[model samples]
Target: MSMMVNSPLYPDDVDILAGALYAWCAERSIKLQSQEGLFAANVAISLYDAGYHTQDQLLGALHNYEFH
Candidate 1:
């Protein structure tokens, strides 16, 4: 599956990363629930905490998701 960054859903302070991740998941028809979102959120947070905010950075840093 291919991964790409997306725009923020809500306001500027909302979970921009989650929104991007969700968009990526949707593009691949990958369903994500609270649990899945949490996992991705964790990964997103990790990348953000590391001072990385690009979609490529997030996709590069995460490796546990099964994309079809």
Candidate 2:
């Protein structure tokens, strides 16, 4: 899912990714508050867009619960 940066609807992408991540987490028995999970997903996406082009970067973002 691609989100248009700097657009009014950009924040909506956070919700979209959050929902997907939330479901994935739930399936894995990971308990994440809605806001926390959403922020984590958003940070992952941001790090990706920032040219952190590696699996490690993605994993780090997801595992870094202090992001929010």
lDDT of each: 0.56, 0.54
TM-score of each: 0.47, 0.42
Q: How far is candidate 1 from the true structure (C-alpha RMSD, Å)?
A: 8.3
Give lDDT for model 1: 0.56
lDDT of 2 at 29: 67
Looking at model 2, which ten-residue stretch has the lowest summed lDDT?
1-10
**TM-score, model 1 to reference:** 0.47
Candidate 2 residue spans exceeding 4 A from truth: 1-33, 61-68
Global lDDT of model 2: 0.54
The sequence of per-residue lDDT tens digits that candidate 2 reaches over residues 13-55 is 5554455556546655656666655555566566556654455
Query: How many backbone overlaps does candidate 1 show?
Result: 0
Model number with the top lDDT: 1
Pairs that collide in candidate 2 are none
